[model samples]
Target: MDQAPGSPQGPQDAPSLPKCYRHPDRDTGISCTRCERPICTECMISASVGFQCPECVRTGSGTGHAPDANRPRTIAGGSITDDSFLVTKILIGINVAVFVMVLALGERFLAETELIGYAYSPQLSEIVGVAHGQWYRLVTAVFLHQELPHILFNMLGLWFLGRIVEPALGRSRFIAVYLLSGLGGSALAYLLAAPNQPSLGASGAIFGLMGAFAVLARRTNIDMRPVLIILAVSLVLTFTRPDISWEGHIGGLVAGALITLGLVYAPRDRRTLVQLATCAAVLLLILATVVGRTVSLT
Candidate 1:
């Protein structure tokens, strides 16, 4: 119980200082709040509860911790994954599948699938209306292309534009824009082209994506020269080429631009609501145009 002067004390007689786990030689009074490992100030990161070691911070990040605003975020506010372009892939798949079906089923099938009759053709009587109520032709025609070259060009456009636009707009909004733009094209063709003329292909939707891309670029204040050039070339092709559906291209461009305008310009406080309303209104306008054309033809 008694010690002589200058004699070493027993282990229990003196308090032990903790050393940093990372730097064993360095004495650190601090311990990680999560892992409880001793860490020096240099190895510690401030956490909500207390200081955490670098290893614990990394581990927590891997386990679903929320990222800061500057990091890339998915539609659900999670980390970006490999399937960011899933919707675009699915659209391309559907278009390819339908083209295959057209090849297998022959000309009759292609004729039936494309948007036809009063709106699409010139010779058909307005009063006759769409045979067997094939109202879906307005949408389905977008996926049907007759020639190899036609499908190739459209799919290439989709692949290029989809990759750029899909990630920016998210899955739902991108798909909505594509489908609605296709419908808008069909409606325009019905109103402008010969009543009996049949039209098919994804050009309308592709053009729509182009338009959306232009709007997005403008919103972000990027250079518009490239977009403007592409658009001008496409418009020239539409007008100069007798076979091209100029009406469809113009309609889709307008529709896509309007929809993207609403999405990009929405107020931060009610972004989702405003975006949905904007897209819905564009779709309704397309539907109304189709109905009005149908009545005129009748």
Candidate 2:
């Protein structure tokens, strides 16, 4: 039985209860401090100031009151921000841009961009030269790709490997490993390939990443069978493929392994110094090898 409106009754009807804003059916005595709206316990969020409703929490986040755990942290003395594989993305962008430029320039420009042996021809001055001023080819050749498939495969490999390696090593060291590995590949190619032979691609750097992965895995005592198997398959392909530069592949692999070894095995004390020294030593060795090989050619 209900009481008539504005009529005195034997028993007054209970007052209507407040409902949660989010869950309207849910009756609640609690209300949000900011909005003063009724809210259920489930809608409550812990806050430094006090308990807040979800809406208030979201508003606080927009005002920089919330801590975002997902944000990337700085590493390597803040030299690299672990802020979403930025170095890897930049590398990919540069590679793609260069590829586009090469396509626009045509086959003649593409041939000129190749890492040709110094002894091959005086006609293509852009070809990498050990004795000439075109030594930049050691690094530049890694960015050049001859075909669509070539860049596609190499970029895919880089995307896969860079995501893993860059995060582990941070941006600066990862870049160092990449450039050194590429230089190593070019160095060996210069030393071993026929003076007339021309080769270009990022396969060397990719192989270097594989080698680094293997070394890091081994040092960490992680099962390395998969890495080793992949490495073996790559080595087999390098040897069997008539067009592949086995010298570059092997050189890059060795360089990557050595660099990672230094990084992994460095003593806890003066660790950064040791790693830097190790990289410096590797670079000097590669430079010496290039100089010696060039003198021999002369």
Candidate 3:
């Protein structure tokens, strides 16, 4: 059915300019300051920042026109958000749970015997050596802390820094940072350790956080001088303490920095799944190398 010549269509089919509360008769373009309803040029008034209708400006309800008001609020000191709260909780829980297990096993097992020790020592090891070797120790040692203070400080640091770092990078990337850092630390400790001496701790991963923080600061528009100071202090402590694994600390730091660089520069608009898959591939490569070296050495 065609319309008769020069006949106006019904309201449903009519070509009407959208209604403007400010100027009903005028073609709607700009929006009202107070209600965000489209308004035409005739009824629109210029505000200090944006266009506002006369009624909205008169009523002092033209905040929509203030460009600064719509801008994101900046927190003092520019600290990153505590976005990884759940990740922090899980990591801390795992550390504490493992610590409890260590305590339950008593001082002898905790101090003298480690999974690695059992595998390496000939007299004590029978089938466990064949079943388990120094290879598994690289992963297990990451969860085993020697003393209460040792676990406490590392866990606390993990919570503090992980929360800051995780949200920005997301969980999969954060896990990659943690595991790779721990592995890197273990590798360094293995290289530096005598056959008789045993090394264990999460400090390597904690140091990784410090390194990632420094790298992350470079990407964001945040001042990193304070963070640099914190890292320097940690480095000093790592060197000054004879018992500390300085090699692990340095190794983890380097690994963390490199991994963070990869994550940050990766295209954000790309599918997160692809980047995660890439990370998993890299991690598997590192794991294969670490495990192969450990098995051969043992």
- The candidate, 2 or 3, that scores higher on lDDT is 2
- The ten-residue window of minimal lDDT in model 1 covers 70-79
Q: Which of the predicted structures, 2 or 3, would earn the higher TM-score when compared with the native?
A: 2
Q: Where does candidate 3 stray beyond 4 Å?
A: 1-83, 107-132, 269-285, 288-292, 295-298
Residue-level lDDT of model 3, residues 1-298, one tens digit each, is: 7989998688899676677875567776455433345777777765322355565455444334445433221111111222435766788888888788888876555544342422344544443321245466667777788688999899889988886777556566677788888877777666555545667788888888778777766655346788889998998999998888787788688778877766665553553555565556656755665566556655
Work out the TM-score per prediction: 0.72, 0.71, 0.63
What local lDDT does model 1 show for residue 172? 76
* Per-residue lDDT of model 2, residues 1-298, tens digit only: 8767888754355676799999998997765533446778899654311234776546533544344432222222113242547988898999999999888987666556667656445555444455555677677788898789889988998998887677656678888889899889988998888866777888888888888888755643346787788889989989997889998999999998898888756764676898999899999989998888778766
Model 2 global lDDT (CA atoms, 0 to 1): 0.74
Total clashing pairs in model 2: 0
Clashing pairs in 2: none
**lDDT (Cα atoms) of all candidates against the true structure:** 0.75, 0.74, 0.64
Off by over 4 Å in 2: 1-82, 120-128
Q: Tell me the spans in candidate 1 whose CA falls farther than 4 Å from its real position.
A: 1-63, 67-81, 119-132
Count of backbone collisions in candidate 3? 0
RMSD of each: 17.7, 19.1, 15.9
Screening candidate 1 with a backbone cut-off below 3 angstroms (N, C-alpha, C), the clashing residue pairs are 120-197, 121-194, 121-195, 121-196, 121-197, 122-194, 122-195, 122-196, 122-197
Count of clashes, each model: 9, 0, 0
